[model samples]
Target: MSAQDSVPTPAATAPIDPIPTTSTPDINAAPHDPEDPETGEIEDPDNESSRFYGPEPDSNPSDGDSALGDYRSTRSTSVSSYVYDYQYENGRRYHARRYSTEYDLPNDEKESDRLDLQHHLFLLTLSGALHRAPISKNVQEVLDVGTGTGIWAIDFADQYESSKVTGTDLSPIQPAFVPPNCQFYVDNMEEDWTFDHKFDYIHGRMIVVGMRNWERFFQQCYDNLHPGGWVEIQDLNFPLRCDDGTAGPESPPMTWSSLMIEGAAKLGVDLSASNRFRDIMSNVGFEEVTVEHHAWPINSWPKDQNEKEKGMWVLQNVLEGLQGFSMGYYTRGLRWRAEEVDVFLASVRERMKDKRSHVYLPIGVFYARKPMGI
Candidate 1:
């Protein structure tokens, strides 16, 4: 690897307590008046019941039924590999990159299915919008970095017939039949970009785990994009969070996230880099850098209609993705036995199915633009 592509030494991975826990609020209790002499304690700003949901009406935080319905009933898609050569480990297939850098997830058919499911989950989150950027309809070229199954690229090409979409990844696991305007290539984003023409818009999703030098990655994006073009990154902030104290430190999600963050850092990648994309993009000379904070509830514990639906899909996505997300990382970086890894993952699966646990993954969506007349 070139010096420019070298991964930065990450700080020590800490425990998985991203959100500070507070006492559970009583939904059915009467309101407390500040002037009342009977009430002894005035609630502090940090202890407000509305800390998690700003300006929303107060409701039962733990009101959802404990039953975790059949999340597998959601629709799923399948993929086939165009490239025959692959590397197998722990009975999972990996990319035949033949390079020093390794990816955290497998590239098998099961992982491809999970990627497609995750793409749908994003659609449900965004309410079916392909992107949040305000690009014009005349956009000529588009690029998707680390496009796992090429699902997003295919949809973009179908939506914008005037644009040509290119998807790149380390594995040739994308299907053969796709929109005429969309194409897929097996390549690495950390290397120097060699596209023949600059693009009008670029998008990357869930690529934080495989990336090394995020600054260099954004710099390459800036160099390869036309002036005034936009770039968007969608990723999940690591170390699962809990608004309530139900999913505590001993929870399976917390344990998994802590170990995964440490293991990824040891392997020269930062799992928490999603939290730094906005600052990094601005430092890279991009203008109008903006980020949106969102949450993906682990199960159907939420009360809102849309959020409840999202929770169901997110639960299925996590359940199907856990093994592929951990196998390579544990064995390679953390040095764990294959059987031990399986035993630990079994507990995670069981814990994830509990709807009353109230765990969620924080998501970040960052978008920026290259300055014009540069």
Candidate 2:
């Protein structure tokens, strides 16, 4: 790496809290309002949040369920400002909680996006797009699909002052105030996109399930790029790495995986498509492609000291986020009892803190450049 090259270290990671700013709300700032670190109170402006911790409504905080709700999806296509659905694809039923941002927690999903070290690292990796791929200053337009927290795009706009960065999402949960160079629009990228300028760089991350058509998405990116533009995607496989088989089938970790993997499959999304990263890029007509795979030990698989520490931290975040990822869908999507989801989340939490296990997580990072000349 050159002096200008900065590999994202664990320290550079964004926090799981809502986005905050030094003087004012960052263009996409969404900080949590719980236990305001500044005031030490439970409910303050800082405590106002979309993501919370508790087992059930008005339940104890440790239960953690109290702080959470069903998955929140906002789309312009819906007739109702908010629609609750208990039925998912393939006729599966899961409880789902639906509310409009106009009423419910708005722009608070940043709590979910920057939830932990792994996710923070993921955002850092997205920031790497600036270094890994080069786009022109004259190439003023950029798009960040599934722009969770709008962190990456905000940073991009901060770095490339001359460029305009637009972050699009199905839910307008991104932070509000952003750099003048950056802005956000609410749209389902899966549908047709109406934008004027071709982009210089297009980024999509952790959108594995939301994406139904990888090839088409890539093609869209390719078509929307300025001849030599680039696209970067970051995602990881599920069922994680049980290299030693120490994390058995009956393990909470495994049970958690079973619930997510099966349900996502039922919904027609492939959560385990990490290896397809390159294939999708190639199929989209992108050239000079490259992939970097990393070892992510789930719940600290190694006896090695450092790996164990980071692994455990990663596991803890997964356990916490799983509720919003699936139960929010199941409760909001399938209508499963809050009790059942609570127990499931509890079990996942137990396994995360459980130190007597071996685990690994595999991730794929792929980027490709469109040919500049032809």
Candidate 3:
């Protein structure tokens, strides 16, 4: 059967199982003494502990309050009204809100559901943790940038009941029944932020399309974070890779990815910016930056049972949602007719089913901490 024919129909409601944290070692945990690795004890290399660790929060709580006030005053404009002026091309809808031209993605109910599906796929890939950042239990505030369907924020709120989670996106298509501590805002992250409070943790996933200025965006994230707060950025790398050279420069998948990237570049959206996130975060005054790269196989091509299963899900995600991802970019940015886009994607789908093609997309997770005294 064809890849599209084999694609599993997603259920109406897919349960997001909380990822177990025990399997993955916490990277933010106190480091072991360099002198003695056996004990796993934290020993200060420098005699001055406060200088390296940072001032205790209780020592000067007023500084945090003042910092928050400064950030709030910088961008305190009232929230804009939620607008859903959707544009349709070849039966697929694209968002017509602010930065609409730049986004090149749909925001209708169907697309929202696909985004939620993508969220679950990411969760499965990351082993269930919302992020790789070592967020403290005492965190009181959190922000989710480009929270597609607000699923991450909802899951975060459910995970940390004490923390107030605010999810911002260009579309106001988030569900109504969110956690009590979670709220959705119709806003764009590329614009200047006007948050009233500082966040202990800020999470942004798959937001490369909406961000034109990575430096300015990371700087904004730095400004809005409480001292020592964490920001985690997770994104996918495109132009899918094939290990054995079956899917190569001439392959349909590569052709599709190249076309998409070319189209996105014309719209001023850098789809390949995920690779440079580490440098961007560091230049923005973030400290202790960490990056982890994971792979999502294109189909059930892996010999390992776990990877084979994951690949199946990834295949379904790409096959089912390829049209939603391609329509706007092809029509608006590439100036291609909608019918041509569909025909090209159909060929790409067939190429994906070839077992000889061991293709996978790199999933990069970058987490950084805002320096306490930068």
Candidate 4:
């Protein structure tokens, strides 16, 4: 063999990790619902007056294209969202800001990133990747869609040695020393999926932003899953508005979350997608579906020191992960100036991390199961 042949060719053509540059606010033609709150002109709401009945699964598989609602949002991004790259930064070539679904995020939080044990772990366990389905055997033929850094998949691989674990993402940011049983892939889940084997379990977490169709995505999941399989989705609802009963929706806390939501919506991401989770799961023909709510303290102030420290860990993640995740929601939704967003997120981080703040963190998880025998 030639000396060139002796040199091993690259396995997969690694994707570029470019930061998205959509600074221009496309107000008039933006696809997001409602208005830029500050802009004073509102986009048409999705007939909110009409309640969402469950998504009809068996009707026409292709019908999902029309039946699914559009709530995706993507806005500004920052350093934290991609901070994992700093630790596992290999191919930071693509600055696309974010990648398609089929990615996985690990539970491998750093000592600096450690959050609450009861809350964050519970939030993660209910996410469909870790927990077993009441209907199916331990999740076999598992697929972690959008596995960021392949964290969840790696954990799943460690837990179920017999089961094959595949974590896929649009970006090639997974670590090199993954479990022998765990595998990673670079694929765009927003488009058609071409996998031959159906999965027993499909877990999608924190995929509210940058997603457009809910029905189609769930239907695709149903199609990709084996008979009687279970699919679980863990996502936040509208960023929680602090309710002291006197604070109106326009209060600082409410507006803070709102600005985050609005900007992400402009980018085809749905910051307020939790309300639709059940509707989409039912539409995809999933039966015995259920939703669970978990409260994530934006800052750690829960009266307990241990809980407080946990909150700090999550707060740090919020600080860093924002760049990778919600910065788009805040920056684009609120039309926040860079300095303004930086300052706000920084303060939120500091408060959350403050050992004395004592705040508890929370996020919601939604799960559903496909009925057995068709």
lDDT of 1 by residue, 156-205 (tens): 89889999998887766655556788877667788777767899999999
User: What TM-score number comes out for model 1?
Assistant: 0.80
What is the per-residue lDDT of model 3 for residues 1-374, given as tens digits with 9 covering 90 to 100? 01121111111123232322212212232212323322111122222111111101122111111100110011111112333455666886666644533577777666665676677667666656677789997678898888876778877898899999877776665655567888776666777776667889999998886677888889998999999999998887665666557678888998888888888888887788876777788788899887665667776665544455556667777876899888877888899998898899999999886656767776677789988865
lDDT winner, 2 or 4:
2
Q: List the residue pairs that clash in candidate 1.
A: none
TM-scores for the candidates: 0.80, 0.67, 0.77, 0.64
**Residue pair clashes in candidate 3:** 19-128, 75-194
* Model 2: residues with Cα > 4 Å off, grouped in runs: 1-119, 123-131, 134-139, 300-309, 328-335
Off by over 4 Å in 4: 1-129, 135-138, 245-253, 304-309, 323-326, 330-336, 346-362
Better of 1 and 3 by lDDT: 1
TM-score, model 4 to reference: 0.64
* Model 4 lDDT tens row, 10-121: 1133323443321211122211121223111112224321221111111211111221122111212122333323223211123233334322122233211322222233
Decoy 3 TM-score against native: 0.77
lDDT of 1: 0.71
Q: Say what the RMSD of model 3 is.
A: 15.9
Candidate 2 similarity to native, TM-score:
0.67
Best by TM-score: 1
Local lDDT at 147 for model 4: 63
lDDT of 3: 0.66
